[model samples]
Target: MALLEKLTPGSGSFDNREKIQNQAVSQTFHSAVNFVNHQYAKGCEHIDESTTVCDNDILKSLAFSQMLDRRCSIRKPHTSTCNWILETDAYKHWLQQSTGIFWLKGKPGAGKSTIMRFLYNRLRGECRRSPEKGIALEFFFCARGGELQRIPLGMLRALLNQLFRQDPTARQCIREQYEEKSSAFGYGERTWTWQPQELEVLLQDAIVTAAQTQPVTIFIDALDEAGAQFLSGLANYINQLTTAAKICISCRHYPTPPYIPGVEVRVENHNSGDIATFVNDRLKIGYLTEADSPDSMIWEDLKADLTKLAAGNFQWTDLIVPLVGTKIAEGESPEEVRRCLQIVPDKLGDTYRRILQNVIRQEDYSQTFLLFQWLCLAQRPLSVTEMRYALAAKDMVKSPHRIRCHETASFVKSDERMKRRVNAVSGGLAEVVQLLDGDKERQIVQFIHPSVNHFLLTEGLNLLSKLAGDGKELLAHQTSATEFTSNDTVQRCHSNLYRCCLNYLLSEETPIRTELGQVPGGSELDVRCKSSPWHEYATRFLFKHAEEAAKYRVEELDQGIWL
Candidate 1:
C-alpha cells in the first residue's frame, strides 16, 4: 500500500497522473518476468554443476582401460542382416512399452551378439533424434578378454558410467555415498576400487533417480560368457531393474539364466530370411543372370542348400559362403563346387575339426597343439609379442642348459608374421586382434569366436592330442589307462606354462638381481620393460602358474632342485 501511494503523484493533472500509473504497472510486470528468468537461470546452473561433478575424477574412477573393449570390438551388423528383428512383434512390443525386459536367445555363433548390437544402435539413434525420450547403455561380455570384461563388476561400472553421464540428478543420488567412502578411505583409483556389491547398490540408486525424468534402456550382450556362477544373480538383479527401466540381454540357449519374465526372441526362429538374403548376396551367381544359363540351376540349388544347411546359424553361413566363392573363383565346375559344399559338416563343431586337420601340416602338429594349449588355459590372454617370446621359450626349455634370452628375441617374428603364424597354426580357430591402448597399439591373440573356445576345451582338445601324439598327458579325458579328469588336464596345461615362465626368468636376457638406477624422464626398469616384453608377465604371473601347476604334481618339479 505504501509503495502504491508513493508511486501516485500527490498533486498533478488527471492526464499526467493516469499516465504515471500506467507506467508503474508496466515496470512492475517487466520486473516479475526478469526475476523469474533469473531463478530459472540459477536452476539450470545447478544442474550443470551436478553434471560437471559427475564428469570429473570420481566418474573417471569408475572406468577402466578395457571397460569398453568388448563392446567396441564387436562388428557392426552387415547391411540388411539384422533388419528382420525390427519387424518382429516381440521386438516392437518391447520397444513401445514403458518398462520391461527382453531376452534374445540363440545357439553359439547364431548371431545373438550381432542382433543385440543392432537393437542397441537403433535405440541409440532414436535417443539422438529425440533425447527427451531416454538414453541407451550397453556392455558386451567377453570370456576371452581381460578378467574385468568377463565379470559382473565390469558390467556395472560400464552401465553406471553411462547413467551418471546422461542424468546429473542421478549423480547426486550416489554422490553422498561415494564421497563418504572417499573420505573414510582415500582418493585415487589406485587406492580405492569399487567392489561389485557397492557398484550394484549405486547402480540401483542411479536408475531410480534417472527414471524419474526419463526412461532408461540397457543392453547386455553375451551374458553366457560371464560364466554360470554369475548368471542367476545377474538375472535376478536385472529383474529388479526392470521395475525402473527396460533391460535386454543375449545369451546361448544352454546354461540358461534364471527365468526373468520378459519377451523371448529366439534368434534362430526368425533369422531364416536373413540367412537367405546373405547367401544370395555372397554366392557368386549374379553372372549367370540368364534363367537358362548352363550353371544357373546349379547355383540356385546350391544357394537353397546353403540356407537350409545353415539352419539359422549365421556364422556357419558366413564360413561356408566364402569357401563356395573360392571354389567358384578357381573356375571349378558347378557340380564340383556343390559337392564340396555338401561335404561341409552341417554341425559347426565337425566343420571346425575338418578345418584343423585339413589345413595344418603333419610336421606342425606338436607346435600347433602347444599353441592351442596356451590359448585355451593360459592364466590371462597373451599379447602377440609376448606370445612370440613364449613360443620361443617353449623350444628353448627343451635345452635349458643353452637358455639365452637374446636368441629368443631373434626368433620372434614381426607382428604381421606372427599373426600369419597364429592363423596357420590354429587353422583360423585363433586370431590376432589389434587394440588401441591410449596412443599405443596392442595386438592380442584369441579364438575366432566363443564357440571355437568351447570346442577346443572339449572334444577339440582330445582330437588335437590324438593327431599330434604330443604326450599321454594331453589325452587327459579319453584315455582309460590314465584316469585323469578334465581338471587334471587343465592343471597339466598350467604346469607347462609354469616351466616356460621359469625358463624365461632364468635366461641371461632377464635383468634380474640388478638395481635399476633412476634416470631423467625414465629408469633402467622402464628400458627393461620396453626391451623385454615377457619379463614383466613372467615375474608377475610366475608364482600364480606355479600354484596352479601344484594341483597336478609334476614328478621332476616335486623335488626342490632344478631339473
Candidate 2:
C-alpha cells in the first residue's frame, strides 16, 4: 500500500505515471528483440550458426543472383509455321536417348538448323524433370561465335555452366575437382597442361560423375562450320562419352566428318512433308475461306505448288513461303500468289544471283560476280572479319603493281584495247568493291549451298578456261607482252581452279552416290567424261583447235587430262 501511494497521482500519482511509462517501453523493446531472435534462430537452423544473419539491406546483394539464374529462362519465341518442319518419330526417339552421336547432314536451306532448334526445345523440357536423370541440355549455334569452333570442349563447358546453375551438388563436385588439381599442382610444384584429348577425357569423367546424379544432353548445329578437325575430335569425344551423354550434329553432306556409326538423318526426305504442312498452316481458315474454309481447295493448291517447287529441298520452300506471305500481306489475290510461286527460280544459285544482281549497281556487276566466284571456290566459310582481311591483303598486293590508267591503255594498243581501257576511277572504287565483298562475309560466306558449289565449280571452271584463253590472247597482243610473265599467284589461282573442277568431277558425295556406289559409269566423272551433253560442247569449244584459242589447255591436254 505504501509503494502504491508513492506511485499515485499528484506527488505520488506523477511518480506512478513515470514508472508505468518506463515499464511499457521496456516490454515493447523486449518483445521486438524476441521476435527478431526467433527469426534469426529459424534462419540459422539449416545454416551454420557461426555465420551472422545478414541485414535486410543484404537483399540488395541478391538481385543480380536472381537475375543470373533467370536470364536464359526466357523461351525462344515460337517460330511461325509458314515454314515449320514436322517433328518425326525417328527424330523424337533420337531426342529422348542420351547415347551416341547423331549427325544430321543435308544441303544448305534443307531445314537442318530449323529441325535442330525444334529438337533442342523438346529436349530442354525433358531436362527439366528429374535433374538426376542425367540430362542437361545446352545449344551452340556455330555461326554465333568463334568459341563454337572448339567443338566438344566448347559444348561441354556450355552444358556444365548451365547445369551448375541448377545443381549445387554438381557445382560442388566441379569445385572439388578443381581443388584436387590445384592441390596436386602445389604439392609437385608442376603445372598441368591439358591437350584437347586429355581435356575431353576429364570432361567425360566430370559428366559421367554428374550423370550418376543427372543426365546431360548437348545439341550442336552447323558441324561443318566448326571445321573438319574439330568435328573429328568431337566425334571421337562423343564415342568416349557415349555412355553418359549424347550429341546431335547438323551439317551439309560434303564434309560429313568420318562416320561415327550411329543413326543418320537426312533432311531431304522430310522436305516434302514439312513443306506441305507449312503451306497448309500458312493458308489458315480465313485465308482459305473461298473453297470450304482455308483448309479446302486453295490450301491444297498452294501446298501442291510448293511441293513441286521444293523438290526435296527445304531452303527453296523457306524462301518461297516468305515471298508468298508478303504477297498475301500486300492484299494480293490468291491467284497472284500462285503465279509468283510458279516462277520461283528452281536453281538456288541462280535465284540468289538474281536477287543480288537486282540489289547491286550495274557497273559493279562484273566485280560482284567475280567476288562471288572467289567465295564459292574458298576451302571453307570465311568470317566477315577474315574476308575483310583477305580482301585488304589482295588489294595491298595489287596496289604496288597497279599501272596508271593511261599507261595501261597505252600498253594495250590493239583493237581489243579500245573495248576494255582502264579509267581514272576513285581509289575508293576498290575499297567500295571490297566493302561489298565484306558485307557478304557478314551474312555468312556461304556464297552458294554445297550442291550449288559443286555445279559452279564444275561448269564454272570450263567457263574460266575459256576466259583464260581470251586473257592470254589479249596479253600476247599487248606491247609489253614480253615484260608480262605468269607468276606464282596467277599460277596458284589457276591450279586451284583446275583442282576445284577435278574434285567436283571425282567427288563421291554427289546425290547419285546412293544408287551408283563408285561403279564408274554412273559417277559424275564418268558422266562428264562420256555422256554429258556439255562434254560435246567442252570438247568442241574448249579442246578442239586449242592452239587457235589461247584459252585452251593444249599442252596440258597433250600430256593427258586426268579426271
Candidate 3:
C-alpha cells in the first residue's frame, strides 16, 4: 500500500525526486547559456581593443558627427560656423580642468541653453563609456514658475537621485548617512533638525564622496528664473564642492549669479559664434525653405537675408525662419520677402505687438488690449491657467447685476426701496472672486510674462490712458448718483471708487512723496488739515478742497504721502 501511494503524484518522496531532477536540468541549461554569452562578449571586447582608437579621436569624431547632424536637421540650414570660433581652445581647456562653477551669461534668446545642451550631450556620451573615469552628470532646467519655489531642495534631490542611480555604493552611503543623522523614519527621509547651511554642507560632503568613486558634473540652466536668493545659495554650494565636482551654469546677464571665484564665460560677449552656428543649423532644417515648388528661388534668397538679420542671435532666427518659410511657400518673390523681413521690428515688444495684431481683429480689440494690460500689471508671470482665473474673477465682480422687480402703485412708479435694496445687494460683492469660467481645466488668471507687466505699467498705461480718458467723468457720475447721497453711504462709495481708480493708475505701489504749499483765501474748501494722521482721507480732503481753501491763504502747508 505504501509503495503504491509513493508511485502516485500525491506522495512526498516522489515529488522531492522530481524537483531535484528539474533543478539539475535548469542549472545545466543556465551554465551553457552563460558560457556562450561570456565567450561572445570576450570576442567583441578583443575586436574593440585591436581597433587602435584613442578616446580623444572617438570624442572628436562624435563631436563632429553631432554638429553635422544638427546642421543637417535644421530647416533653414546654414553651416555651424560659430562652434569652432566661440567655443574656443581656451574655454575647452578650462572645461577640461574640472572647474567647479562656470557661469555663462547672455541676453534672452542668446543660445546659452542650446550651447549647454550640446555640452551636456557630449559629456553624457563620454560618461557612458568609462563609468569609473566618467563624471556623474545632473541637469536641472528651471521652467517659468513650475516647481521653482522649492528650487534648492528640488535640485539637491534630483542631483542626489542621479548620483545614486549611477552608483549603488553611493546610494548605500546616502542611506547610511540618513539613518545616522535623521530621526526614526527609515531611510531616505530628510531630517527636520538640519538647517539650510547644514543641509548644504551634508550635500556637498555626499557629492564629494560620490565623486571620489567617479567624477561628477552638474548642469543648471536658467539660474535667473530660479530666483536670486536660490541662485546665490547654489553658487555658494558649488564653490564648496569645487574640490570634487564640476558645475556649469547658464543664466541671463541682468541678474547674474553671485561671484563664486570660478571660471566665468559670458555668452553675449564671447559666444556669438555658437549663436550664429545655432541659427545656421536651424535654417538648414527647412526653416527657411519654400514648402511649394513654385517658390524655390524665393526661399533661397530669403535665407541669405535672414542669416544677416539674425546676426548671431538665435531668437531672431527662431522668429524669422517660420515667417519666411511660410511666405516662400506661398510663392512670394525673394525681393518682397527680404523687404518684409527687413521691416520687421527689432525689439521684443514690437514683435509681440505684431503677433497680437495678427491674432485679434478690431471688434475683439478691447478684450485683447485689457488682457495685455492685465498681463503687464501683474506681480508675477502667471501661467495661462492663472491668467484666465484672474480675468474671470475680475469680470465677475465688475459685471452688471440683474434684479427682479415687483408691480407698484396706480402711478406706475418703481419701488424705490426695492431698487435701493437690489442696488445695495449688488454693491456688497467681494473684491476678489473665483469662477470656473473660460477653459475650466486651464484655470488661468495671471499675466503672460513678467516683461509684459513692465510694458503695460509704462508704455501700455500711457496708451490706455489716452483711450479710456482720465476716469474723472465716471467718478463724477457715480458720486452724483443716489448711491452716494446718504452720509453713511458716501464714505464707503467714495473709498471704493478711489480704490478702483488707484488700481487702474498704479498696478504696483510707487514710493510716495509729499509737497507742501500755501493755500490762498476765499476758496470754497475748508483746509483744516492736521499733521497728526497722514491718512488717505486727509490727502483726499486736501486735494479735493484745494480750490475752495485758496481763499484762506495759509502760509504753512502739510502734505501727506502714502505708498
Predicted model with the maximum lDDT: 1
The sequence of per-residue lDDT tens digits that candidate 2 reaches over residues 396-440 is 212234332223222223323211211101001111112234445
- Give the Å error, residue 394, model 1: 40
- Winner on TM-score between 2 and 3 is 2
Q: In model 2, which runs have C-alpha deviations exceeding 4 angstroms?
A: 1-98, 130-133, 146-153, 166-169, 180-199, 284-303, 312-316, 328-563
Error of 3 at 122 (Å): 0.7
> Which prediction has the highest TM-score against the true structure?
1
- Each model's backbone clash number: 0, 15, 45
State which candidate, 1 or 2, has the greater TM-score. 1
Model 2, residue 550: distance off in Å is 15
Arrange candidates by TM-score, descending. Answer: 1, 2, 3
Model 2 RMSD in Å is: 17.2
